[model samples]
Target: MRRRFVIEAVMVATYGHLLVPSRPIDYVVPYSTILELYDMRDGSDPVMDNADDDAHVRGKISELIAFFEDPLNRKKIEKAMQMPWRESSPLLLSDEIQFTVVHAVDNASYGEFFDPIETELLLTGSKLNVPLLSDQFEFQDRLIEAEVPVQVYDIEDFEFAVEEGISTVDAGLRGE
Candidate 1:
């Protein structure tokens, strides 16, 4: 069986430009580097300004991607994979963040939860019933204080909702 790894990372828009065809832009950035950029952006004296050019943004994104994808980093990730799941911290940076590495197939059925604004990425599935962290409630309160929206849902219920939506769409397409 082919194995796929999901490395949950903080989302960052390093570069964005309007395309003639209106295609959605996608950026692949390392989790830690993006967090650093996010902090800078949120800082009182931001590193980036509205006048920043696309070339600079693109260059930074490329540099960070290359840095993270280097052989040394790959070796680190592989080494982490070999450690006990509970003890291992998969992503090299961001001790503040937590992650659980599971098979990609398991993720498909159980679903993953990500709170971009709070930088909380979770790996969950129906195969495992992991308890929420004690501090998760405090984290949500912090998000509320920061005026960030928070929504909580059961994984199994979410999966059922998604499957129902997909089936409904399929039925509509088939004129049922």
Candidate 2:
């Protein structure tokens, strides 16, 4: 089972770009309207933005959002993060791509609930060397040892991303 706790880090980050905050609706609030509802087009404040191009950002992010939000899909992704993904089925990164890691990340919010998720993914999936694209290099040594070839991954031709080897991860989250 996944554990939860208070995170002490001054700031936190999570991999992937489809996670959005769930806004519970209250019919009693007469002032609220569907127009006021948050949309994925309004992206979050980035820790760093390295993407120069924005063409595929919306499509890719939306595709992932749908995958993660489904109940059966989320469970599979959680299992992948917990165990070597090859032991289970691969996830659909897109309609044509069935990757080993994918899911809804609602409870996987930063600070407390999801602090260890990526760490656990690296730890558990070390043996499989799954094709991963992550911001955190928590287990760089293991990833390298497994011959998984850790190079910078970016769709845009941003010089900073290439120079700094930081892949641009854009996620849509509802900000307060």
Candidate 3:
């Protein structure tokens, strides 16, 4: 679960170069809790499934996915923030990336309404070890006079924000 959060963070950063914010950025995050009698089998339809199938099981999964998939939901997620992300020139320094993290908070929860699951993903310096590329680098005094700039940072350096969430229940207790 932690790994997924980290991956999502990096993905959001790297893809920011390709993403444009569509709304006023807010930072209040919404956490969800689903209460189900039991769990469901993967790929099994609860509507026509067996006795083990739970009625509210699929609803929870669908709701969870929808919250993170819809653009509207993403807007809502950003609404929980302190500052809004606007169009800026390509990032060139570690400080710029760090600025984003200061306002990034964990406001996600996944569990049953009563007995739900909860996880937290906090960002620290260790989480963002790499720096954003300031400028293309070249070997100035090489034997050959070839002049080419090389990409020096991971694509994740550019990710500015995220509008995603995740949820999971306990193990061995699936409804379907």
lDDT to native, each model: 0.32, 0.30, 0.26
| Candidate of highest lDDT | 1
Question: Against the true structure, candidate 2 has what lDDT?
Answer: 0.30
At residue 14, candidate 1 shows an lDDT of 39
| Residue ranges of candidate 1 with Cα displaced over 4 Å | 1-53, 81-106, 110-121, 124-176
- Ranking the candidates on lDDT from highest down gives 1, 2, 3
Residue 103 lDDT (model 2) = 22
Model 1 alpha-carbon miss at residue 144, Å: 14
RMSD over all Cα atoms, model 1? 17.2
Kindly give the stretch of ten consecutive residues in candidate 2 with the minimal lDDT sum.
25-34
- Clashing pairs in model 1? none
Candidate 3 C-alpha lDDT tens digits along 66-157: 43445754454445333432211222122222112222223332121111121111121113321122211221121013211111222333
Q: Name the runs in model 2 displaced over 4 angstroms.
A: 1-43, 47-59, 70-88, 93-96, 102-118, 127-176
**What TM-score, to 2 decimals, does candidate 1 have?**
0.28
Per-residue accuracy of model 1 over 1-176 as CA lDDT, tens digit each: 11111122322223221111122211112233334544444445533465454445545545545544567655554454463332222433232222333322222221223344234222221112221121245654553455322222222232232233233134232221
